[model samples]
Target: MRKTMLPVFTVIFFALGWALFSLSNTTVSQIQPRTLTLATTTSTVDSGLLDRLNPVFEEKFNAQVHMLSLGTGAALRTAENGDADVVLVHARSAEDAFIEAGFGINRRDVMFNDFIVVGPSNDPANIHNLESASEAFTRIAQTQSLFVSRGDQSGTHQKEQVVWATANINPQGNWHLSVGQGMGNTLLQSSELGAYTISDRGTWLALKDRLNLEVLIEGPVKGGDLILLNPYGVIAVNPAHHSDRDYELAMAYIGFLTSIEAQQMIDDFRIDDEPLFFADALNEQPNFEQYVPQSR
Candidate 1:
């Protein structure tokens, strides 16, 4: 009986050792080099900009960027979850708070486009050449225009909220419809419904051909709410949050995204020969970058 028990114990020990060795081999196989995960806002992806931008980075760096584009809030949540190696987003307040909290490091300002109030050709709100985004909203409110809001808690939506605040309008009643859709779909809905709306200029340009809506009013010209400035930024996700985080790839992507060549691509990318985003990442950015740097 003792010999039989001894043999069974040895067999079990060998099986456990084999299992451990197999797991170790599997772990080694899973290890990857020069790979990154990035969480970003939908605008960067939806406008088909990434489709143009990422290939260059991949070729140059010999790295892979697994990008996840969600709303600003959801993007930030990815960083918080240690699921992303980097982040590219538009919410300055949230990004600042993220860096301050040590969840993000090495932030660099990237490109930008202003928001626009778009509506049907009928000009229901009659908000063309308004000059001030706030004033345009005031006009829209007073005129009771049919406004379709993305209402998806995205960076664009955040800017819209600020514009409404500037307009000193709460925005209640029949003229408003919250679609809670992505940028492209929202544009389609606004076009199909012939409703007025506020949207990022990049998105508008990207989808302008398929949609009937035209620019009703330009939000903020340069920086102020008048410019209704929309900026994109890249930040390294703090590695402390995830031990296996790909900091090397994240840093590479940051360097690539903020590189002069990348900025030039941004400057050069256009729809129908019209510039969509003005690059603001390198030595010379738009005026907004001067005001908001990595520190403040």
Candidate 2:
């Protein structure tokens, strides 16, 4: 009986050892890289900034960054729905509204590139060199010169709406073409139609060589107009709202964006010796309360 018991115990020990080894192998094999999802505007993707920036973060952290390039409104909605970990967008009013609704937290200013109006080289609307974007829109409408509108609720579209509102012109007609497209497509369409459209300077600079369109109205950065000042912000989706959201990773991403290294990368990113985005993360201390919506 003792001999039989010894063999049984040996078999049991071997089985347990094999089981533990198998479990260890399974765990090691199943290890996956951390993934962080970011929803941002198309302008960022179009300007190729992410292409230049994302790889550095991924390699340093051993994580993968999945980016969804949508319109600013759509990107915010994506984060609100818990589909994205964070957002990088330019529309301050919308970003404030999102935070006010409790869908986001830890909002930080990232970078900025002003918006510009571009049109045909011939300058049919005679809006070239205009100091006011509103006045430029007014001329386009008055002449009924074809104007391409993004129509989609993008940040660029929101700025366009503001300019139209400031001009006090209810633009509607065959001449006002609302394409409901992304910035790159809108610029292409504007070029195809020889029409006027508003574009972010970064994208305009990146893709200008491909399109027939030329910058006709500069934003404040180039001393064109104050209303065209376009600032961008990065916001992490509130983990309180969505417990599954990778809030820690999102904050890390935001940290990397505002870090000295990333900010310098943004400053150094250029097209044809012209910096597309001005780094404001370190230098600017904007009124935070101004962007945060007050409870009524």
lDDT of each: 0.80, 0.89
In TM-score terms, candidate 2 sits at 0.86
TM-score of each: 0.81, 0.86
Residues 1-296 of candidate 1: C-alpha lDDT, one tens digit per residue: 45558789899999999999998787444545366788987888877788899878877776667889898878988888898889998877778778888888878888877888788998866777667888888888888877888887788887888878877899888887888888888889989989888788877887898998888676554433555788777888888877778888888888888788888998998877778788877663345543334475
Using lDDT as the measure, which candidate wins?
Answer: 2
Best by TM-score: 2
How many pairs of residues collide in model 2? 0
